[model samples]
Target chain A: MAKENKTNINRRQFLKSTAIAAASMAAIGAGVTYIQKYKRDENNAQELLRPPGAIDEDAFLYACIKCGLCVQICPVHAIKFAGINEDLAYGTPYINAREQACDFSCDSIQCAETCPTAALYFIQFKEAGLKAIEAVQQQGPEALKNINPFEVQVVAMKKVTHIGVAKLNEKTCLAVKGKGFSGTPRGENFNGVLRPQSIKNQDGSKIRKAYPLKEQKYEREICDLCVTECPIGEEAITLKKTTNPDGSVSYKPNVLEGCTGCGVCEMICPTEPASIVIEAGKTYEEVYS
Target chain B: MSLFSKKREPLPPKKNDEMPHSKLGMPYKEWMGMNEDRHKWRNRRWAFLVFINLLFVISFALDLSLLEGSLSGSRLLGFYLLDPYNSFQLLAISIKTEYLPYLTMNFVIGFFTIVIFYSIMGGRSFCSWVCPYHFLAEWAEKLHDYLVKKKKIKEHSFQRGLRYVFWAGFILLAFFTQRLVFETLNPVGILSRAMIYGPGLILLWVLVIIAFEIVYSKRFWCRYVCPIGATWSIIGNISPVAVKFELDKCGHCRKCQDVCLVPHELWFVTRGKATNEKHYVGSDCTRCGYCVDVCPGDALNFTVKGLDKIL
Candidate 1:
């Protein structure tokens, strides 16, 4: 009986040992197959180059935690999430503002300021978008006017696009004939005026109401908000001198790049009816053809 | 067949003149043995790992300093990484201009180098001798063993399945979050942050978890949680180094299994039977050699699997 029991134990031990060896072999085989099939392919090289406007592609890619702060704070909604190919290069947090160009006139460097990581540096006023505008302005108005507003010709107009509209209420028209207020009021004279134009409201209503005297008093002289803030360069609203056939000079307003869809002009318009109101659409007109 | 024949033949009397002496001072064999003993205690492997960790910490600090401009060298390194002008020489060669390449490369290289080195020498040497995180886990396990004094809770098959399910869920979370959550749970990271950030509520909570692990479980982090360990285990299966057992010498005492921190219960499952169990050591083994020391029959031994066959 003891001999039989000992033989049974020996057989059991052999079977157990064989089973363990087989399982280990299977596990090793599986591991080998996984490594062979799933190892990272290092040959793909398309995403290596630094994207446009990135100061340092390598630094930004490594440091960016992909918090999406820049995307949230963009006032113009100019910045957009990068696509897969771009993501591979930029790692998770990357922005492309080409679709909607940046407006240099905004008061805040919202994107840079809100970036949790220093992926985008907090540039000073002179170093940020404002500097790009100043540089172009220094080159003379003719040079500025000659620029292709739609093309990101200047850095200031990085991703600008028409996002809204500016409409006026005819009832609020203070300068129309037979209105309560006509022409520029006292102390309201045009000087460094970049653009002057008839404005419309968001619903395409013409404002005909009497323009508030106090507001108009400042609007004529310092109201470069529309022209300066327009993402496009040709000054969406321009002041023009209408010459009569008899050589008489009369002042009139004109819309050049229609109105850069950005509603900055509407936001800053001072009038109650908002001489300019931004609505969703491509309001900027084609300048090239 | 006579076991006492060798002993019976040794009839020489002790001669003080015949005793070998070292000219310097101590006997050569005694001195050499003493030195070897000291080296064994010092454990050069552990020291190497600590040195690597320190190097990494120093490099990280230097990178931070570069941004402040307090250190020119660091600033230069930053510039090299973050070329603001988009006109760096290194950028020309790199496939991706993004900084992510550098970070990913660092992790991949570190992991593979250690794995390859340990696999060549013995199974999972990094875990046993060098990993800072493993050291922390081991310490915690000791504390847990001392405080809890609990018997092994035999895990049900269903409970074992739950671990894999949780692991899958965590992997999905990591994919979506784009953050290695397992890495975040690393005790090393916890300890480092606690030391640096200090006295915060979160740090306190982490400490509580550590205390709990110290009291209730043996290698709680390693057995169930550590994704790095999971990854290593998967990779280590193909490792050529392993422990072997001599079938003739094993006494079936089960002493080796008792000493093993990892539940060797599954070993039987793999082996197909309980009694015939062989030492199926591979990459999963941390090369701690605890089993080898605990084996009463002296049957267990470390061997280079593929190389021994080749020789």
Candidate 2:
């Protein structure tokens, strides 16, 4: 009996140790296989919106060090780390447009500026978006004078389509519903803003003044906050007048070619979930793939 | 065969009381100044980790944008964001979402270069020596040691294997979900966000971790759970450097295992007896040198295996 007890103790230790070792090996193998198979799938990431000036979704995934630096330095605190449920974008910085938009409150994109690697690609903004880059290569910051400074800086440094275009959900939009709004979109307590554009007056003289979107009162027979409150202004979103079934005219928010997707419209939209949503990391391609 | 070799006689001195001053206990004249060098590599590791974490925290806290173009405000001075998991996440997500080629020079550098660095370092020296969360965990360990005073303590052995499961599950889930799911639970990201943005649900997660570490865990998070440590440990298994044992010099004091985060690995390596070649070289061994420092026998030292010949 004593001899059998000794043998049993040794056997138990052996079994326990082997089981742990085997589990570890199995886990490692499965992990490697999972990563390998995922790599082969082309449509694994159907949608992801990286911060502006990010190179590519795949490159951004590995390039970002997950330091949370970008999330830290945003002047408006627009940037946030992706939550655990967000798959591979976890720990990486991204913007949730409806909650808060990248107002460029830092004058330029601060998140991209502070990224250590080319993950955020400071080079993307060094030239600005492609057009701004082309403009600089052709004329210089002087040629970019007539355009919005923020637009010039961003476009000169990166792709215009770096983020997605904002599409308005017509059925719910205040303007599309033919409902006129008279007060602040979010209420007096809110702190949202409308970036005053370099607008041309009657004599074509430009007037630019930025004010809190919540402080500004709107009184249109058809609400145009989606257009008026858009930080990118007409360059990104526009109000298109259309005839309703009652023969009454209403306006639909149209995303234009110049939409750089700063996502201000999505933030200031009066709708609960926001009538406009930025389909992050998309182009005119329009499909998820 | 067992993690605890045997009960140690007397008690080890706490770190605070090790130093004495005139107003405090020993006179200044008798002190002959302070012998600050308690553990060479161990203290150095502590200092380096503190420096790294401080730099990371400060960089995350500062706003260089206001000082743009100024030397003090230079945007270049940000944290390395050098967590290995970032590259791992990229590798997993890139494969699942797109083809492998979507990876770039940056991804290649972060992924391959860092892995090579870990492989050469033997095991995860970074976890004990550089990871931001480690400094806090060490303090928690010290606190637990103080709190667990005379009571018999037992480790939840099952949780030891959970880290392996976590490491594997994280990668597999990343592939299946094509999300950087591990990033959400990343202590660095969570803590950094908490510090920079003010405490919220992220900090709540931190509180949960603190409760686990201080109350129930023996540094279980790092020893078994972290995927980053798991990755480094695997890569570091064949690491050229390790904490070697001098069996001839050993007094069988078992102080080394008492201070070690992963004592089982040390026990495994030093099963029959401690020696240079077969000494503790576990992958998850963070090379923190707690074992080396506390070893009353002076049997352990960080060494480059084969290079022991030159010495």
Candidate 3:
């Protein structure tokens, strides 16, 4: 009878400890699940513009360690780490194009090159650059005179760099409204900077340097900042002119396949809410399909 | 309800303070002032933490490329230095082959380099000596102690074992979500990134945690949670280097326990508790050497596995 009593107590003790263990494990599992769901929901609410050469969004999240190597290497200080409220994207490098778009001033896509984890994979850009050199070399001296191999390489690199696609809101566009813009695009107090396209120095050598947007002035009969300020030039964006029924020609900025969605157009837009915006993680096909 | 309903109180004093001196005639408070005045190891540890974090800032600001990344991953003189915990999280999420190439050779080498380094030096040394967040948390702990001493707030604690649960939970979380979920809210990575890349909105979250530590709990993040520390503790288990406790030299004053960051590791420091004359401090000790500095009788000191026998 005593032995039976001892066995009963042992079983009860075992059951109690096991129940406690199971309860704690369940609580932890539930907490982690809740956090995952909350983070995913928060992340889904908005999309972020990743640095140039960033892999697919889902893979980028898994691979990036949030080391900030890309952030440190960016010469323009364009790449910034996402804040906590960014949900699953927190600590990841992103470009807030409105504050300061990636001007590609480094010409090397230095941020992507320096990425320790290849979260901003650079192989495609490298391949693009190599292919440009090969195409120029294949055409021999004739192409060499017309095309500076370096310029071709830079353009080739830019061609493959797609962080997002730029979308135009014709309803809010100053160009579509047939209004002229004078003075700075973003106003006198704006701190955003951009490197003007290749300018010749005194010795006839081209030099590119970034200048604060507030210091530069523009006089456009019809606002063309989206078209003019585009880093990828006419291939990416162009001013489309159409003849009206009244025989008057009106112009609208057209976004084309060559657009890298680098967000410079969005930054320089004079509209309250940018008339042209980068649809992050989007392709030209998806936007137009 | 029971967890929240418990009455808040300052932790009771550890042991009675009847005798100022131990049987060996070594005094407690004397060592306190002396150690504080010439705390060489503590000063060196502080300098190391400051230097490492500053290197990241300098490398970026000057374009030196000396130490080019945050604690999550970095390049030290062009050699990869990836954090093992971050690598594990990466592996957990990358079970599918589509993103398999992301785990390049550089990352694998970096990961093993850290693991090998920690296995030799003892793992938690990184927490005390290198981690930027650990440095901040240590200061916060000092402020917490002061607040508790003044009765401004009560010290609340949870089971230290909870950290292990969190460590496992994080990896499991990655497996389930196919994302490095912990990286989103990891305070260690956030603090490091903030130091190098400037402040982010998530710094507010880190501030909330520090405030909670100061007012509600004492070293809550480092003690009860922190999967990073939990990861280190596992690596620290087979470490050859550790704090060696000399049983006979112990005074039973409990000053060492009071000063220890993780006191449970010093359990055998009590009189008549230890089976051996010399016992290595447990893997969770962090090798901070606070107990060594506070020990009036010189009971605990750092030792390497076979080095002591030869010397």
Q: Compared to the true structure, candidate 2 yields what TM-score?
A: 0.63
Residue A145 accuracy (lDDT) in model 1: 93
Candidate order by decreasing TM-score: 3, 2, 1
**Predicted structure with the largest DockQ when compared to the true one:** 3
User: Quality of candidate 2's docking, in CAPRI categories?
Assistant: incorrect
* Number of the top-ranking candidate, with TM-score as the measure: 3
Candidate 3: TM-score of chain A is 0.84
Query: What tens digits encode model 3's per-residue C-alpha lDDT throughout B1-311?
Result: 01112234322322334333444355566644434444656777788889988998899878887998898889898888888887887777667535666556787788888888888888488899888878888889999999999998898865666776667777876776666766666788888888887787778878988988989988888886688888888877778888887765665667788878888887776654655667787777788878887776677888998999999
- TM-scores of chain B, in order: 0.57, 0.74, 0.87
User: Deviation in angstroms for B81 in model 3?
Assistant: 2.5
**Native-to-model Cα distance after best TM-score fit, residue A171 in candidate 3, in Å:** 3.3
Worst 10 residues of 1 chain A by lDDT: A43-52
Model 1 share of native interface contacts: 0.00
Rank candidates, DockQ, best first.
3, 2, 1
| Candidate 1 chain B worst ten-residue window by lDDT | B67-76
**By how many angstroms RMSD does model 2 differ from the true structure?**
9.4
What DockQ results do all the predictions give, each relative to the true complex? 0.03, 0.13, 0.30
